[model samples]
Target: MAFIQIIEGRTSRFDEMQALTEEFRERSEGASTVRRGIETRDRDDPNRFMVLVFFDSYESAMENSNRPETDEFSQKMMELVDGPPTFHNLDVLKDETS
Candidate 1:
């Protein structure tokens, strides 16, 4: 089962945030535990963004969080966000395709 983390926040510096997000991917790509990631912005409010990161497991996600690179990335993220981000932790119970 994949462990997922959803992060949503408002960022006035949307362009800067996009660049930082790419940097985050580059830094973390070595960690095979990170399965996938996606980012989206609200059409009504471009500054409002949401990012979903998928991990192989909750443990792996925790390990990623402990990395110094992740800490640096997080700090940069906080600086760009207008306010604190909201996180939703999820255990994927099922993923089905027809």
Candidate 2:
């Protein structure tokens, strides 16, 4: 089944966050594991950001999450944020059909 991961955080360092976004884009570009991704900032809360990532399957998502590039990117993400990020892993059942 296709899976989605939602990552939410508040950033104190915008420059570092921008760099991390670039790094994530670079790492995800050629990755066969990632299906799609969208990053957005909360309209009501400027410090809040969310990333929605999709994968072909749970296993593929886990594999990508464990990659060295992902690990390094995660580290940079941590450094750029104010608090620990909240992650939600979900199985996407229906979308367009719904």
Candidate 3:
């Protein structure tokens, strides 16, 4: 099943975060298990942000999480945020395209 991880947080350092994300993408390259990702900002709150990351399976996500570079990236992300980020892990039950 496809796995999605939703991460939500408030950050005043979005530009820095964006740069870090780009760096992570370059570093991970083919090693990353992420199939897709969507970055969004809350309409009502400029500082609030959310990221939805997709993986082929829960195991793939777990594998990415276990990577040392992933850990480093996560720690850096925490530093840029106002507080601890909220995470939601979901297993896709249905997916359809027209």
Candidate 4:
């Protein structure tokens, strides 16, 4: 089943955060299990943001999580955030597109 991980946090350093994300993408190219990633900032509160990462399966997500690059990115990302981020691990039960 498809899996999605939701990461929410508040960061005043979005530009740097984005750069790190791009860098990670480059470094993990071809080896990453990430199917897609969507980054969003809250409309009412610009500092609040959420990242939705999609993967083919829960195991794939875990594999990606265990990578050294992922660990490095996460540590650096934490430094840019206001506080520890919240995470939501979801198992996709339905998906459709028009």
Sort the predicted structures by lDDT, highest score first: 4, 3, 1, 2
Q: Ten-residue segment with the worst summed lDDT in candidate 4?
A: 12-21
CA RMSD, predictions in order: 1.2, 1.8, 0.7, 0.6
Q: List the residue pairs that clash in candidate 2.
A: none
Clash count list over all predictions: 0, 0, 0, 0
TM-score of each: 0.93, 0.89, 0.97, 0.97
Which residue pairs overlap in candidate 4's backbone? none
What is the C-alpha RMSD, rounded to one decimal, of candidate 3?
0.7
Q: How many residue-pair clashes does candidate 2 contain?
A: 0
Name the best candidate (by lDDT): 4
- Which parts of model 3 have CA positions greater than 4 angstroms off? none
| lDDT (C-alpha, whole model) for all candidates | 0.90, 0.86, 0.96, 0.97
Q: Give the TM-score comparing model 3 with the true structure, all chains together.
A: 0.97
Candidate 2 TM-score over all chains jointly: 0.89
Model 2: worst 10 consecutive residues (lDDT sum): 23-32
How high is the lDDT of residue 84 in model 2? 98
Q: Could you arrange the candidates by TM-score from highest to lowest?
A: 4, 3, 1, 2
* Residue-level lDDT tens digits of model 3 in 57-96: 9999999999999999999999999999999999999999
